[model samples]
Target: MTEQRLRALVYGDVDLNLIDGSAIWAQSMVRALRAAGCRVTLVLKAPVRTGRLVDPLTELDGVLVRHPHAEGLVDGDAPMTVPQAHAVLGRVDGDHPHDLVVVRGRAIAAALAGDGAFRNRLWPYLTDVPQNLAGFTPEIHGDLRRIARAARTLLCQTEELRCFLEQTVPEACGKSVLFPPTVVVPPELADPAPRTANTPLRLVYTGKFALRWNTFEMTGLPTRLTNAGVPAELDMVGDKIHDERDDPDFADRMRRALESAPGVHWHGGHPREKAMAIAAGADIGLSWRAPELDASLELSTKVLEFGALGLPVLLNRTPMHETLLGEDYPLFAASEDDAVDALRRAAQNPDLYALAAARCRAAADGFTLERAAERLRAALAEVYPQPSVAVAGPPLKVVVCGHDLKFFTRLLQHLAALPGLDVRVDPWRTLSEHDEERSRELAAWADVVICEWCGPNALWYARHKKARQRLIVRLHRFELESGWPQKLDIDRVDQVVCVSPHYAALTAEATGWPTEKITVVPNWVDVAQLDRPKLPGARFHLGFIGAAPSRKRLDLAVDVVEELRRRDPRFTLFVKSKLPWEYWWIWKRPEERAHYEALFRRIAASPSLAEGVVFDGYGGDVAAWLRRVGFVLSTSDDESFHLAPAEGMASGAVPVVRNWPGADTIYDRRWIHRDAGEMADAIEVIVKGGRWDEERRIGQGQVRDGYGLPRVRDAWEEIVRGR
Candidate 1:
């Protein structure tokens, strides 16, 4: 039987282009559901008038976008009435009903709650719970209770809101799911703006100037910071909307306040992308509001938006903010005076500001679109389970388990694109015996299970494998020395994959497993992603990637750089890695700690070695970084197909591999060196002998032919299918 595509219908009363909370929530939801392999149709009650117009039949990233009326609904208006919502739903759901119907606004939810057509398909996404609703009349409260009880799934933005809903309507407790708003950008684009001691502190605000937001107090922040002897500026990127019923002169009053404040630039209004761009270039984001009027038990989306742009936020000290940003976040404030002091301190102390900014960036990872999609997919899977059926050629269910997602994400992508394969990935960063239940679930769902590393995941599958399930475990260099190999039940596993024959032999001896069970499979590399032209002045530069732990022999790399700098001062060593001292586990080991400590001491004592070495911190742009590195050095004491040199070689960089236990099995013999002196001699030949370009071409050709993704995929398929 052919698989059916999952379909979802998202209904909202807000205009898609409006710069409001409802629009943001609706658009993000649509994008996330679409990314999770659902055919989504977004039905908006009003038309989009600002930015780009999303046509009624237009598709975006596989999502079918639609807006019913062009001018019937006003921008930034209240939610649509019951009759209007019914008309829109009737037009959209003509003949075939959607598998899932997600409504955003409370008014829309109330309208559809009693409709028998949407009985088990309705999912109400509540963005806000108004405090005034607690004192509602009996008739109105009954409507809310009915809506909450009738929803197939009640989605809340935060845990506090979820709890609040369960208290207000007890039946919702069982069906409620916490679904936070999300915004995701690539690392290269989301890089934080550089901060320096001399640079003026830039504070940004990007929301409506409602009186409840305490815009009046925010207008005076820049002046207050300046008076405190700190150079500061504020960039306000929104406009004040006038509501005659609430406050007739609020917009004029805000305009006058902005004019009176010095060093405050009022950038009236901007689209979402423009606003995020302005925020990304700034140093800080402001999210202050009056506590009495702030009904946000759920998190403020503005805080998350700024964090997604890599800016630390200065939000009020509320329960929601504390939960998301942590209790110890230094930028939390309760009053204008507190905010002023926080800004002053951040401006005066560069290190403090950098640390806080890093924390904010780290916090943003939890609310990424990818994570949001995972939640949605899990929820949908529970609601709509796939049917088990016999077919002519069923897709092979393959589950790839790993501790590091970075190593397996690309490989999973390759597997997912294959014709007759269904791949699922389960990544446990610090896998232990406690994760046995999760491992068992993943293993039971697979026809073939491949463990990326010979760690806890491999051991779990080895002990728990079903007779019908085919198990494969891949071992790298580190696993060969670890005690995990001896504990594995080799009888349960079908195959053990090694990157090189040398490691295959070592693994067989370590585990006492038959040699027939071991096989060599080269790691796949995306050659196209790495093949870039060399940057200017890259010929003399030497690069080392992954310098963690003491066994990497980074000191040997420095020795090679020290020798080369004697002949020519232009040669430099660029080391790309996370510093080993940052990890507590590595530093706690006495021998490992002393080895790195002494290595740093030697570098500190040598002027040439210290000056010639450049530490490039861990980053995602390896392909771009390799362009500036002419020679890639691998100075490890042992190895099982170290991929750094192969990746560098694909980028037209000459490989300089040190002779190790398995180096000969993977790399060409000519590139292998016995010691630092031999490595320096190879570098000298490449540079002084003018063989840089020739060696680069040869290395690139070798890696592309040997380790390309297509060749690796074919080999994996053959082993997995037992063909």
Candidate 2:
């Protein structure tokens, strides 16, 4: 049977006629949600006009648009009046009831706060800081609190705002989700046009020229660049002023500045598409705003739009800008002079400008329509969870229970991508540590429960699972050696998954489970994220990851580095792991503590080993770390699937696996070595004979083709489906 599509209603006090930020947001959001399989209905507070040249409703595909009217409610106001609430409620109740109702304005949020009927359906999208609400009354605050308490989710524009709301309104702590402004690039500007050396540095500003945005500096920017000996031009693609009712003289002041400034063209108020087209040809984008207003916590839609067009933005140096673009980003402007200097630098070196533009484009990916849709879908799923069982042609409900989320997060992502599967995670930090009720709830919600490790989580589900639910437990090398496997209910579990065939055989022997129940499923790796350009001196650098237990054989890694140092002094071993003493559990074992201490002492005593080894403490940036590593060394005594080598291989690094029990089964025998001497010989031959590149390519290809997310996901799908 076909499943029912989700229904969503997005309403706000936004003007559709004006081609402004709010209009762009409404259009993009409606389109994005529609694209994510949602039947969206957009309700605007203002009345629909027929006199306009283009209808906004016609532009937004698959979205039903409505304009509901109230007698006394103004466009932007707090504490919604009684008539306003009645008008909105009447419209919703008069029509088909929506599964989700997204209120964009605070007034609208207030209007619906008291309605218990819309509580579960309400999702308040607070664009700005609630603290910044103008004419903030005690009544409005009460309404906000009520709305926060009632709404299923409170959507925030930025993480800063989310954190602020969580702190200020503690009631909204676990119910907020970040829904940043997204950029939708047209096909023409999808891929950035490369800027040439001789092209004049064309800077484009495409938003309201308000005083708050520092329109005065924008007008004089072109002249400043020219004075700095850089051939530049500025294109201002927006109105001369904004909020003219409050500041009537601001437009005239801006016009006077623009008229006086040379090499500045004011093409005011074009359609968003036309403006973006103009922006697409520009070398750089400008987003210099007044810091005193302190709206830095809010993400600038202008920056994201510019990035979507693949142009590097010349933004103000603020915490928000630093968060979006890195601190070391070349185009940050503190003053008008700083902006000029940045433009001059970019104009002088086209290569530097290209690099900066590329970085901006890459950063923009996180705020694209697709990414926003994914986040929205995930958020909605949590609010309105799918049922565990279907009425007919049952869809699979998979519950992934795990102790460590490091490996299982990737697997969960893959499982979520599969068709006809409703997957959820039940993570416990340790075997014994878990919410018993939550674990049982998750187990009850599943057709198949997969325990990531054969630990307490596995046993917990085995004892608590429903009669109809199938249980599958995975056993890594360490789990087989541990006593937990013996305690597991072998009769309750339908199958056992192992990382490799060797581990599968060993697990069956250890647990005395039927051989027919054991199967192999390799670990999934994100090949796309790992496939990055290797650093310049990476070829000579050997890397070791995860040196926690004494069994990892850090001493063996030292021996390999020492042997490599004899051939070439440039060879260095970069250990990307935590020191043994850093883990409190490792220090509890006297023998393990003594072994690690003795190894550290030996390294300190030996000048060659100490000089050759560089210990980079535990880091979350494995992709960045792997770029500096040319060879990934797995010197473990035993591993079901040592992911470090596979990750390294995906990052264009060759794998040098020490022949543990399951190492040969997971990795190619050509890369696996019998001992430290053979490992050194293999490294020497590969590096000296120029076979490193070939080996790197082969290893990377193997990982991408074999252990990639798609292949691993397919394997899990097949096993769960009883194929």
Candidate 3:
């Protein structure tokens, strides 16, 4: 890398020396640039005449030089006298001899307007202010147009912010880059005084409160925590908005609500430092950036600051937090009871809290001032590479196949993570029956196609198409074992990415496809946070998770329980199926229904072995239930990486799985049983040997180490980038 010094002129509402959003951005930006080995000069618009040479400049980590320029027209960093501002800009331009001129607002438009030489590489950092200001004046409109045309880069806070710019300033669409706000400095943090064994956990929330400041209604996490008596407090550090306080009708309603709330405190408007000071002593930090019409595109500095202070945060689930804290932090419920339960859970298990805190520290390491500077340096290098610059159009078009809402949504989320990829998914539902026009149009628009069509005729139609677009077809359980579709249809697919290598081989053998074209990308479940709760009593009970009637074979489960009952009547079955009645629904005719009903009625009525099976239907914590079950039995006839067995593996359950067509290989040894009789034998062996705990320990460790999302995401990134 070559050593290059870059000067930056930052004009915004808040001063870094002072406090607020603008300050955070400028301070962090300056620190980041300096760490990137660039000398930065921050230009601000405070009155220079009224005061003696007031040093508006404050150094951040000794890397950034903050200069407060005396701006006369607008007291704040807003549009001012065009030519006068230009004259000031010219003076700064001449004095600095900077490589890049950073313009944040219209106040410096004249300075940027005069000549192409000066305006050529203007990088304006927009903070979502352009869209919300009161009236749209001619000068404001003209200044925005000029900035859009003249600026080399428009650094936005979010994709939502970028999309807004695309719609409002159509011409500046290609130049926009999403850059969320970040912390410029690590706050002073200290470990809380050690609590007594019987002491309640201390939970704290510190931030602003108002219509735009806090999101009290949307996320009910705080409410849940308070109700559970987890010793929580929502500390409102800022004064409520004027409208909320002065308006009698609104103020009454607000006070009544706040007063009714038990564990919340309104500490009305403390100094920024004081608020942070109060936050430093808490065990758990609450950094929820309340959702606002304008702030959905916003990432708060609070969460980052909390992390820097070594406090594990319970954040609101937003795109901004999701991006920065990816697998580095934990999130909690937005309800009162949930928050309380979360605190209770944390208090009961210090290990979890400690792990979360460690992760928070790890996240802070990556989000430090130096790291941010590196990111800023890279962004600037991309925008102002060498001396020559040319704006490039959006790169690569990404077309996703299968328009089922869930699949497409997940696919879009993953694709969205990769920058510069234009993504669009064809709504597959409409084409499910047949629609030539829509299908061809979708194929025409896509540069690369991903289709899930299994029928041979459909693949043949796609094979004959004229387009040279690369095709990727994904196959899971339905396509692997279903007799409805023949294997010859797969020859039309260019490449196949299956959920499991076992299934891939099974499909290739069944379809008679060459092995080279098939790649196994195991069926991935988004187990983003799959850690199970510790329940000691979970060692005795046996369980099975899943609802498919024929595939799961509930009958086999009943038989296994009865057989186990013969050896030891204490062996209970905990069936974690979504629905018990759905087992009978699979039968079409009255005879089939009657047979299922008779068997179910007999099992329900029998006092001997039937009482041992308890059907605990759908639950929130499936993984936890898995922990509660000592032996996980999956007697399925067909499966594609059955989730129940996988979850069981995650939760330390000894998997008594059948040699189902697609899932037989998930076990450590060769599946010894293909039929229900064999499954009964396996269950009996597990119960008699009393080695379920050991099996569970080995299985959970294997899954946690190999099949978790981090490993899967790395695999996915490689596939997407063609690495």
Best by TM-score: 2
Question: Clashing pairs in model 1?
Answer: none
TM-scores, one per candidate: 0.52, 0.63, 0.47
Under the 3 Å rule for N, CA and C atoms, how many clashes does model 2 have? 0
Whole-model lDDT per candidate: 0.78, 0.78, 0.57
Clashes per candidate, residues 3 or more apart or on different chains: 0, 0, 19
The regions of model 2 sitting more than 4 angstroms off are 1-26, 29-38, 41-58, 65-204, 208-218, 221-234, 240-255, 274-471, 482-493, 508-514, 528-543, 559-578, 582-585, 602-631, 650-654, 674-698
lDDT of 1: 0.78
lDDT per residue, candidate 1, 579-692, as tens digits?
Answer: 987878888899988888888898888888888899886765576678779999999987678899999999899999999888888899989999999999999988899999
272 Cα displacement, candidate 1 (Å): 1.2
Q: Tell how far residue 331 is off in model 1, in angstroms.
A: 0.8
What would the per-residue lDDT of candidate 3 be over residues 268-320, giving only the tens digit for each residue? 54444565666666667765443343235555667666666667777655544
Prediction 3 TM-score vs. true = 0.47
Q: Candidate 3: which stretches are off by over 4 Å? A: 1-394, 403-412, 430-432, 476-491, 534-536, 562-572, 578-585, 589-595, 608-611, 616-631, 651-654, 661-664, 670-697, 704-706, 710-723
